[model samples]
Target chain A: MSDQVTPSPGKRRIGVYVCHCGGNISDYVDVDRVIDAVKDEADVVVARDAMFTCSDVTQEEIAKDIREQGLDGLVVASCSPKLHTTTFRGVARRGGLNPYQYTQANIREQCSWAHTDDREGATGKAISLVRAAVARTRLSEPLEPLVVETTGRAVVVGGGVAGMRAAIGLADMGLGVFLVEREAELGGWVGDLPKMFPNGTDGHELARRLQDEIHRRPAINVFTRAEVVEKTGTYGNYQVTVRAGGEQIRLDVGQVIVATGFASYEPEPGEFGYGAPGVVTLADFTRMLDEAGSPLVYHGRPVKTIAYIYCVGSRNETHPYCSRYCCSAAVHASLLVTAADPGVRQYHLYRDMRTYGRHELEYIESRRRGSVYMKFADDEPPLVTSDDGSLRVTVRDLLTGGDQLAIGPDLVVLVTGMVPRDNAELTTALKLPVGLDGFFNEIHPKLRPVETVVDGVSICGACQGPKTVAESVASGLAAAAQAAAVLKRGVAELDPQVTFVHPEACTGCGQCVGACPYSAISLVERGPAKVASIDAAACKGCGGCVPSCPEDAIDLAGYTDAQIRSMIDSLLVGSET
Target chain B: MTPVPAHAGTGRGPRAPHGGGPRVLVFSTNGISDPGIDLAGSSHMHYPTEVVVISLPCTSGVKPSWILHALERGFDGVFIAADGEECAYLQDCSERSAGIVERAQELMEAHGIDGRRLRMAAICSVCAEPFTRQVRAFAGSLAGLAEVAA
Candidate 1:
């Protein structure tokens, strides 16, 4: 009890302010009484109330008071820290105090509005919460952000449009880039396509153009027939080892961008009349269309009718998610067929046409150009049966009152979807997180779309999820911009609230090794005694490994054990409940 | 003379607001459940004033001694607002947090405290209703225990 929150009277000068919140709080709790309650406490040199503690004038006044009185600890009983921890930390900094010296007490959300019916109770609770914060401030040691130097190079996995574009983007920003492709050539899945949508550029031609640009850049090194075998070290100083041509080459880099592309889904034998003479996947059909002349001949048969099936292996119980780009690709393919020969009859069997955005015009154009789209329900899917090298497709038309329709055509094209490539080896080496859909998961789908939980690692292109050519390129450049922003500054700043390993208390038990999520903790010899050592740069300050140690040897810096215990004691003294 | 720590008023008078109610200390994850608890307040959802929340970076960081300390300091119960899969730190966050709760419960049993006094449930980022409802239910159970003791 002697070492608990008893701030020595004249040693620590603290300032406490309770906000009225413009009646948001004062309507329910007595803000002035809260000030009167704690003003006479030993360490409180200044106790005040503000109409809005977050206001500009009040902020200036708090800074002025801190400077005039030489106050060390500051507490503002106002809004949640999520909203204004930075705003008040600025005041602490301007007053010549460390930013971590400031503490926020959430009275509006946690007290006043929560217990509107009981004003007396809310005030008592507010006093407890604020005093608990003040006690924590009294014990908090000033901490500086951890800064580490960074290598000025990045590694891009895969040599698809996204990877090639990311490498070009990184090199353009004056950073060296290493582009690795699994295949013998520089192009990837996108490079093998017939003609990409939204533009009539040939796949091989586009790949050649990107390859030429990459070859011209002296900073960009292209490695074909390679794979990222191992990655070690923390962010900003990673050593990535790539295996190429029976040799392993290690590259020191600051960031790793995973642009590994998706795999084309292949239908099983006899499913949707596949393995028959005329039945082929959309990918196979497109390649055949590129080789054949007008009238669309396959197996030397020029006179023909074609039927297409949508969503071959996705959007069901097994996959349970829509492959986003198939509908537009199918519609664009139908337009290409019509351009070859307008007299050839074509029918598209589908469920939910999702040609979103401007691509909706392509669906409309395909329909206007003599291709018929028949909608089908989920339960009543189209069935394909072959009769002597010819195909018959039957479906219940959803748009036309569930009417059953049957059509015999010479060609049956199955519009297969994209599936995530099984990157089991790479996943283990980099600790990449995979979603339920089997695609690599981002931190946030919208805000931090390219960044992974692993620091300095970014996922781009179809490997993350299904994306069109344009979207893949967009994410590629975005990952490059993020990597550039991290490495170009030549330094990385991490939170100082990471865990601290007390050597005297540690017994080298190795309990915290398995507990650390970031693999930041390791057992090392300390004066012939084994002890846990933590890499502060790799730690995310989650304090996840603190409780796993049996000896209580490790603790978080900002929210230490002594500080937490003192906080609870301050709120519970004189009570035996 | 050293400054005396400001303590909560403990008048033995007629059940004061802070004196009678079962005081529960909550360990909430800063990234996930803290914002949800705050949303519960912003939505004007009501819970007992006896509920106090202390935000930690993650629930896995909770030590069993912290729970025992709260109980020994006269807290009626301890609630852990877990982060579940929403924890950006670890993929196995739920399992690690459950391990902590188990150890805390064992400590409670050793100290002659009922294991039922401590509770844990996953509260996500926007789960305002769940946050209020669970805390209210926990308060009722703690109050019933008090009645049984009396």
Candidate 2:
């Protein structure tokens, strides 16, 4: 109450205008009926209904009416304020009235649209909504927005293709970007591969292009072997701390993009002979292929037999998922190896030959070559062991219905899988929810893929979960697009669906304040009595404060229990249940 | 015959490399029956991937696995669009399949794969994704995997 923005106390003149929204609401909920019913209300000075109150021409009409009619407060009963609260607020400011003195009533989604056939009930609900707004507007204060400082620069985490893409996108937009990489180099796991799918260009080339572009950009600041240590503040202004090369550096940023990428499972050294001289993971194999520019050779001689074990880190009752790329990578690798040496006996010991797409054609052609395709059931996996000092694998052959066939192979290639990163730390740090698989969760699965439940934060790349390079790049662009939308606004208006404490009725009970999970409420001394005030920017409209209020003083805007009960009563008024 | 886990950490809880799981998930982009039927069967034995059977209509439906995090939290693993190009839903299965595959692999590398437990795949509508078999084999092989030292 030290600097309360209470409105000037006096006889308040209220204006109520209902919009047709070009029949979006008027058709179902009788707009004229709503205006007619509220016209006689004690404090209402003018009540009118318009075909489209949100339209530019109509908004201008509203501003003109306020000036000529000397209106003190305004109420617009139209679509959800989510769509036009700014529109009406802009009009109020232009008309020399404090924009905070306006109230919005949603009669579309909650009433008319919800109760389609019940016209009488719909109209009654509309009246209640209007009445609630009117009541709230009567207690409205002339509030001013708090100006939080902005940090001009931004931090882009994760140095993968998506991180690089976002960093470039942000830098090109004239914003300084700090690109951080967890690994030693800028190119992510993609750099270790042989080539990309479809277009089939060397993965190293794409990595180089991105690395060079980022390096050349003057606005881009690159940091490898770095991790985000701390982040605070709100959207458009954030203070981020990073730990890189054992040095802690703090930076003020306008935004942050979490492109922390994903990690594939690397089996323990002993399991599957992963680290043995003759054994290698698909990633390692790919790296070796890239290094040698050819198939694997043992002791400077062409290898006669090579055994590939599929589902090394994926698909089991325990792990229960397919590392989607392993099969394709194996197929691609097999094709490359076969093309390099036709006489090489390549046995693709798999539960299934998943050479999908053009690889299917390749699998078909490669099988005709010296490459062998075998299937093993989930219950019957291939066993790799040394028989008489010779590396041999025993697998149940699905085609021949046989078991324990030993093949003295020269090399064993294990195809591994992918999973989320150390997401628990990330989830706790950001107060974000993790999926069952322990990945960052998005707000809406389809509509808001990049957006989180928290405003101003977005997730991209494998940090969210499993995905391919192309998909990761696309999601990176999507997250950037979403973050840009919020940044473009420069300042976001706090949503009005928040709770307010009746200062006079409050008894200094800290229950409600403590109950607020969003940390929106606090008590301050107003003369003699301690009053609770809500920090609107931090409120998330969760209504958690209501139950903890012992004085019955806390009331929420847009959805007070009384207002909801009244609306519900009206909806069920003429129904037979 | 012993059940080949769909993912790692099937019988042994923490020993499986990286991935976490008790539930088995099957990542199928198309029908359960496909040209690579054996691969689909193996997919059912892995750790997290063995719990839920996610039949994606197309690779495009994989989204950014972050989108379905709620669903993932409820299960052990999430097996989605697999590797290969037999998708009847999306014509560009090659790119879409590759995208899903890459995403899953990255997750595994990050140690978020349930101790390297979760998985994803790429497959066509007619034949369940081939990555399913690979996932199962990977899980079965995790008996000797080292536990993450506390």
Best by DockQ: 1
Please give the distance, in angstroms, between residue A98's alpha carbon in candidate 1 and its true position after superposition: 1.8
Assess every candidate by TM-score.
0.83, 0.58
Report DockQ per prediction, comma-separated.
0.42, 0.02
lDDT tens digits by residue: candidate 1, B28-145: 9877799899999999999988889999988888888898887766677889999886676677788898888899888878767788889999998788999999999998888887
Q: What C-alpha lDDT values do all the predictions have? A: 0.85, 0.63
Best by TM-score: 1
How do the residues A452-518 of candidate 2 rate in per-residue lDDT, one tens digit apiece?
6455667888888767788788998887776665555565545555678778889987877766544
* Alpha-carbon lDDT of model 2: 0.63
Instruction: Compute the DockQ of candidate 1.
Output: 0.42
Off by over 4 Å in 2: A1-151, A268-279, A293-295, A298-302, A307-309, A315-323, A347-412, A498-534, A542-557, A567-577, B1-150
By DockQ thresholds, what CAPRI class is model 1?
acceptable
